[model samples]
Target: MLGATGLLGSKIYDRLHRNGHEVLPASRATGVDAYSGQGVAAALTGADVVVDALDMKTMSRRRATDFFTTCAKNITATAAEVGVGRLVCVSIYGADDPDAGRAYGYYAAKAAQERIYASAQVPATVVLSTQWFELIEDVVRRASLGPVTLLPAMRMAPLSADAAAAAVADVAMNPHSGPTVVVRGAEEADTLDLARVILQERGSIAGRRPRVLRQLPYLGRAIAGGALLPQEADTVVPGGIRDWVRAAH
Candidate 1:
């Protein structure tokens, strides 16, 4: 596990460990840096499976591209050197589609990472997942300006981080031979609706009325509509927006 302390990676680590699998959780805290190639080889030694759940905080195109490409190159090369057979990568849905999310630097970098995996010496499986329920807070924060919030008129299907982590663990342990697989939530929703739900939940938490004008605007340069929705054939995880909101309360 490359990012064992992350939001999704920690859950993956716990699930894999609970299943009686010996997992070496690697992260910055564990002194493993994929960019500098520090402490990666020792972590890979005697390990058969390599799960790349690494994440970056920046959205800069050049920086993100460099970070992902360098990390992928270093990790894959080291894995191949140590005789690691299976490489599982966690990625976003629609990353393979060049037309989708072209305006976003993060998505573009993700696409580049997928290309690296496709051409890697060791066989790789990419687990494509939708947005997580935990992202609602960040979305609300980014969309907010004073007492008003502008949401995108876009559709999204979001799953819990736990569900996504479970899927990753299953794929890593069972070893999916396919190049890519998708996992998503049980229901589809618009961005405005999600924002409303989150605001209402927060209001209830604080015991004060929520005051915010909600408006729908085009999300980004590229996200028009249905770009974030999962395919019909994609694996849908259990639970929906209402369930998640209720649980959050």
Candidate 2:
């Protein structure tokens, strides 16, 4: 697992290890730079399949593009150079969309990375999963100012990070001869509605009354109008907001 420390990467590394697969956790934490080829070869020395879960979490266009683009090029080159057979990557649901938000520059960066893999001779599969439940929490936190909270009225089918990670492991174990398999959550809920549920649950313990402001006019309309919806379906992971919260609690 390339990004063995992230939300998904940690879960993936654990799942693979617990399932009896000796999974190696690769990252800059281990002095292995997936983007710079510093320790990539050494880290991937004995690995048969590589799961790239490195996340470039930033709002800057240039930073995001640089991260994933460089990651894609270096990972593909090094994996092929090391003679690794299959590569599995965790990408966003709408990463291929060119009109996604500037905040979604990471998605565009991921897409650019996919382009490198697509052209590479190494067999690779990009698993595009929907936003996780924690993303809902992030949206609420970002929009919150004291008691008032605003969220994108947009729709989301938030998947479980653990399930997404498991799916990545499954794909890695069974190397596929395809371009990419897009996975979304079970059901679609309005962003505000989902936020309300999460806030209400967390609010019980956190002692905060978060008011939801949905789709206020102006730029809010653009945010509310399906800016983050998955257009295709391949594999839908199980679990919902309630399930996630229950587990977290």
Candidate 3:
């Protein structure tokens, strides 16, 4: 299991371990750097399945593109050399769509990563998931200014991190040979509505209302209307934004 210390990766590692699977959790902290191929071979020795949950930190176009492309190249090469059976990658819901947030460096990099996996020698399964409920706070913070928050008027169906992890684990263990599989939350909502719920939750927590005006705009160049929304054929998880927020608060 690569990136075993991350939010979703940790859940996958725990689930695999609890199910009596012999899983090796590898990451930068464990001296397995996928970007440089350092310690990757030793980690993959005697391993049959590899779940790649690796994530990049940068959003710069050049840096983000290099980070994912390099990591994918190194990881796939090493996994193929080791004769790994299946390579499961966790990507975003709209990564395959050329018109979905293409201007965003992160989205473009993700699309490149998917392309890398699709052509890899080892059989690969790309599990695309929607935004996570855990990211609401960060999105709110980034969209906020002095006294106003400008959110994108885009539509999305977000799942909890746990739900995403569960879906990833199922794909990793089952070993499916397919083009791609998308997972999303049970309900669809606009970004503004989700932001409102987040603000309300925070206000209830602090016992005081936050004085902030909400507005909408086309945040990403390629995001408009329901462009980021998953298709009807995609798998829908059980929890929605409201259920996740209520349980969290």
Q: RMSD in Å for candidate 2, one decimal?
A: 2.6
User: What TM-score does prediction 1 earn?
Assistant: 0.91
- Least well predicted 10-residue stretch by lDDT in candidate 1: 204-213
Per-prediction TM-score: 0.91, 0.88, 0.92
lDDT per residue as tens, model 3, 88-183: 999987765676646566888888999999999989999889888877666666666665666656678888998888888878778654767788
lDDT of 1 by residue, 1-249 (tens): 898888999999999999999999987778889999999898887887999998887758799889999999999999999988799999988655555546567878988998899899998998899888887666666666665666556567888999999999988987655888789998887766776776566663122233664546453534546676666634798888778888866
Candidate number with greatest lDDT: 1
lDDT of every predicted structure (CA atoms): 0.80, 0.74, 0.79
Question: All candidates: CA RMSD in angstroms?
Answer: 2.3, 2.6, 2.2
Model 1: residues >4 Å from true position, as ranges? Answer: 202-210, 213-222
Tens-digit per-residue lDDT, 23-44, candidate 2: 8787777899987889988987
Pick by TM-score: 2 or 3, better one: 3
Candidate 2, residue 2: lDDT: 86
